[model samples]
Target: MEKERREKEEREEKERREKEGREKKKGERARRKRNREWRKRERKKGERERKIKEKKRERKKGERERERRKRERRERRKKGEREDREKEERREKGEREERERRERERERKEKERCDEGERERDRERRKRERKRGERKKAEREREESEIGEREREKGERERKIKERKKGERERERRERERRKKKEERREKGEREERERRQRGERENGREREKQ
Candidate 1:
């Protein structure tokens, strides 16, 4: 009975040791699994934070680029305005010069007209002096002079007619050129307005895209 009890006690002790060893191994496996899960969670969180940080940096960079581009556009627009003003000033200067030249040309033409009138007066006085001679000789002289005068008058009339035609054609050409300039100005204005509208639409599209 003592030997049987001792054997039974020894078996119980061995069983208890084996059960404790198995529970310790199970606990180690659970700890390893929890460590792996914690490492995976930490890795995922780091990745998420890195991605969010990168995205924020990228967004900030994009905003800076956009602002820089906007500033450049504004500067370019200001430069264009300055250039336009310079061009306008140049055009006005050219117009003033043109007016001065036209006035000078008109004064020269008046002087020429006065000289021609004086020449005509001298010719008439010579004709009157010739009329004071003998009757038949005077009549012959008058006929020849009248014939010459008629030729001169015909040539003057033809010259005047040619001048009139040239003036009319020049007036017509100037009118056409003026009309073309006006049309070009109108077209340019329309194009500018259209470009503005297109830019507005593009801005709206970009806003919608961002949203």
Candidate 2:
């Protein structure tokens, strides 16, 4: 009977130990499962953080690229403006030279007219000297008086005709100058319109880029 009791106690102790071992195994399994789940959650969080950081980096890089392009465009525009200014200066110099040439031509024309008048006076003096002689002088003087009167009438007619022609020519020249001015103004307006349109197009492109 004591042996039976000892055997029963041993069996019960063995069973309890086995059950404790199973419970310990279950606890270990639960701990491992919890650790795996925590690791998975951490991994997902880390992945999400990495993606956000990557997106931020990409955005920063893009911004930097955009800024670089903007700076380059600005530099190009400044160079173009400087070139245009130089061209304008050259054009002004050419115009000044042209005006000076026209003024010199006008002076030469006036000097030629004065020289022609002096030559006509010298011819008239030589003719008067040749006629200054003898008994024919009285008859020559009478004829001279008649010729001078006829010449005076002719000169008055020529002067009147010249004044009328000059008036007409002056009006024509004024009209031509006015027409040229109007044409130049129209061309300038067209160019200004084109520049404005180009500016507007550039503004639209910039807005689209921003969008």
- Judged by whole-model lDDT over C-alpha atoms, candidate 1 comes out at 0.72
How does residue 127 of candidate 1 score in lDDT?
61
User: Tens-digit lDDT track for model 2 on 111-184?
Assistant: 67768776577557545644553235466556756875687578658856976787689669868976996798
**Alpha-carbon local distance difference test for all models:** 0.72, 0.71
Candidate 2 Cα lDDT to native: 0.71
- How many residue pairs clash in each candidate at the backbone level? 0, 0
- With candidate 1 superimposed using the best TM-score fit, by how many Å does residue 49's alpha carbon deviate from the native? 1.6
Clashing pairs in 1: none
What is the per-residue lDDT of model 1 for residues 1-211, given as tens digits with 9 covering 90 to 100? 9999999999999999978866775687578669767976996698689769967986897688669757875786577568757865786697568757866775676667768777677557646644553455557657866875687578658856976787689669868976996798689769966986786588557656744
Over all chains combined, what TM-score does candidate 1 have? Answer: 0.46
